[model samples]
Target: MCSGIEHGSCRVSDDGRLVWAHVVLGPEEDWQECRVVLDARDGRELARLPLDGAASGSHHMSHPDGLHMGLCVGMGQDGILLHWARRDGEELTGRDLDESSDRILMDVHPGHPGFLTVEHHGADLTLHALDGTVLAEGVPEPSDEEDPPRWDHSCGFVDADTVIASTVESDEDPDRPLHWMLDARTLRVRDAVVYPTGRVRGHVRPLGDGTWLTYDDGSGTLDRWTVATASA
Candidate 1:
């Protein structure tokens, strides 16, 4: 019986057995928050932990194992606070990843022990371990097409060896939207993914099963794409 909260934001666990929601404490203006872990089967409260000193968070993403998670307090270039979380049955604990306050909670790599974030205003994308270890980091080369292509705020792992990264479209070059396939380990530009329908997506979700899903907003449909090999 959860009640009396101004708002609640939830995300289903990767295993599909539980749900995690950030239950905001009243008068969100005061900057208090709680993370509630609930059972998916019956919506039972498995655990709840209070977050101190966090005014608000943009979104929450669960680790593929369903035992850990990361959340960004603010979104975009305004993002400053990112938190790492873990739980054991009815017990949950969380803390800030680093004191630096420079992280954007982009997406968690499916089946990997780390998550992804854009650093220095998308100048580089980095992979981080749950405890905040920089696993890998890379920046795209200056686009030969655009004078200087900027990394879009959206990106995610296509597989263990590849990452589907994006470049935002500009009013001057709206038709130049691109999905770059970056070598996961080196973060080097490998190739461009020719979206079957030529639609640009804001996000790409890596399904643990060697495939990923892309949504076409124009047609309101979802298309699953296979992770491409460097040769293919």
Candidate 2:
């Protein structure tokens, strides 16, 4: 049992071997902070690290390897927090990829040690190696042709070769928000897609087969989407 579970960040690794969470250290309003790595089966606390100067930790994604996990302060920050599951007490690193700031962790590649990040909205989408080298970045055309579109905050890998993302239109038809399939390496838009629903700020998660999931706030339900369906 953990306290402050609602305000914390939590995730279980793909292999089901570990669990990581960020919780407040003290009272509610004065909530001091730290992240905890736990033994998944027994709910034992394996380690905890303090997050100084952060309002609260929110976004968390696990690496496919099960030992590497990424954490973000969930604000418009300049870095991502990486933690090693095997390391002892308070073990973590605050990393900023060479020149990229205000970028947040979106997802980690399943076959590689690298991760993905995008500027606050969908402005600058970049992939960086574990050593901070840029693997690839996006070059989408300007949205000025129509009303400017706002880059979305959620995106992730649908497979080793592709990524899925959303775009919020400011002047374009608001009825159809733009979703995209991008090449994992070159970050090129392979396809543009839309949903039967309206604009929402949530995640596009790959379900390990050919399907993806999105949250439809209007219905308060998880909506399923697929690339094959869109193409047909």
Candidate 3:
């Protein structure tokens, strides 16, 4: 196990040479500081970049070409900040995602170019493109007669046409009971899957053969399901 004490958020760079880790180095009450550390091949620190402000929900997505990385920065009470990083002559240069709406950014799709999904006021969900354009926006519908649609926290894409999102009925219980798979091209809920485990943080990724790999954080295991069966 790596003993550097990483705070949960981590990403493996496309080059596979470094592991970008997001760390919080302060008390819980205070603003959580954010920084990225480049771990060398020998398990040693190579470089560190401290962010401008403290970030709450920190997520990372690498560029398709793997030469650049996108850092999704979320403020506890304020909103979200998108940071772009690229190699600058042996150094990494970064900047803000844009100068427009700074709502609480929830998650980003790994396969889409400049595609961002955000949550605001804890209930509203919106999708954004690379140029900060709103691609799609809506409120999740109630899952059942007893449970009404409430809030969703995270999302990931399985391919160019599909996205899996987490949904809950209330803030008191954030564990998503239903995993929704939406059509990216249509921005409509195509199907819903009842997780065998209770509320969990899960991500959907394609496996190249009409299959998907669902990583359920709550269960600490991976579940492979065919798109056809998962949708049915």
lDDT (tens digit, per residue) of candidate 2 on 98-174? 33366777787666556777776557678877655778888454554554455577677777777877765532456
Model 3 per-residue lDDT tens digits across residues 152-221 = 5555566666666656543344643456667765457776665444443455554424456667565688
- TM-score-wise, the better of 2 and 3 is 2
Clashing pairs in 1: none
Candidate ranking under TM-score, highest first, comes to 1, 2, 3
Cα error of candidate 1 at position 155, Å: 1.3
lDDT of candidate 1 at residue 214, scale 0 to 100? 69
Q: Candidate 1 — worst ten consecutive residues by lDDT sum?
A: 1-10
For each candidate in turn, the TM-score is 0.73, 0.72, 0.62
lDDT of 2: 0.64
Best by lDDT: 1
Q: Which stretches of candidate 1 lie over 4 Å from their true place?
A: 1-8, 14-17, 26-31, 39-46, 53-57, 75-78, 99-101, 144-147, 169-177, 195-208, 212-223, 227-232
Pairs that collide in candidate 2 are: 78-102
**How many residue pairs in model 1 have overlapping backbones?**
0
